[model samples]
Target: MTTTPKHDERIATMTFASVYPHYVTKVEKKGRTKAELHQVIRWLTGFDDVRLQELIIENVTFKTFFEQATINPNAHLIKGVICGYRIEDIETPLTKEVRYLDKLVDELAKGRKMEKILRSTS
Candidate 1:
């Protein structure tokens, strides 16, 4: 008998609060700005704390990495490191789809196919 693997759909709907316990609570605390919250997420996800701290000090927020992963319905973060990256580095398919949509928008804009301009450049 052959069996196919069952797909899980609940994986993508997870928020930071669900994946990382108390993550939201941590962000709500004082002294942790939005930028710092992103840094903490990065650190938890696999980016080196030292490296993240350096980048955070420079005002660089890498939240997109995490935001990208929560959109997938079958994606989940493992409890180990892979190729020097944490499992949290894995992105959700939903976010990937959103990125594709964004790319499409850019392509459409370059082609001047959009009727109304959503952006203004002077």
Candidate 2:
């Protein structure tokens, strides 16, 4: 497997709350705003600002976080590598979803435009 079972398991159990601060820090350090970060996340997960804050407070694991999400239809448009794994090539569904989120945040931190990152057809 390109990713170890152990590694996958760890990500599944990891709390979305735990990694949220890091995501914020990464984007902020790049001069991006948390609202933009939240926008990216909302585009992917369909969680509005209010629900997202609730999820953070609930400390849900990635598995639960995704289970409750209404993933955007355009999510298939999120294609690229993140953390050394190609998003399109990842076989596991959950892992692919996680990578999709990671890839978006990376794009934001790299200064990709919101429309492009959101896969808008304009």
lDDT tens digits, residue span 61-86, model 1: 22343443333222232123422323
lDDT of each: 0.34, 0.93
Q: Which RMSD values do the candidates have, in order?
A: 16.3, 1.1
lDDT agreement of model 1 with the native: 0.34
Over 4 Å off, model 1: 1-44, 63-122
Can you tell me which runs of candidate 2 are displaced by over 4 Å? Answer: none
Say which candidate scores most in TM-score: 2
Question: Which ten residues in a row are the worst by lDDT in model 1?
Answer: 1-10
Error of 1 at 4 (Å): 34
lDDT of 2 at 103: 94
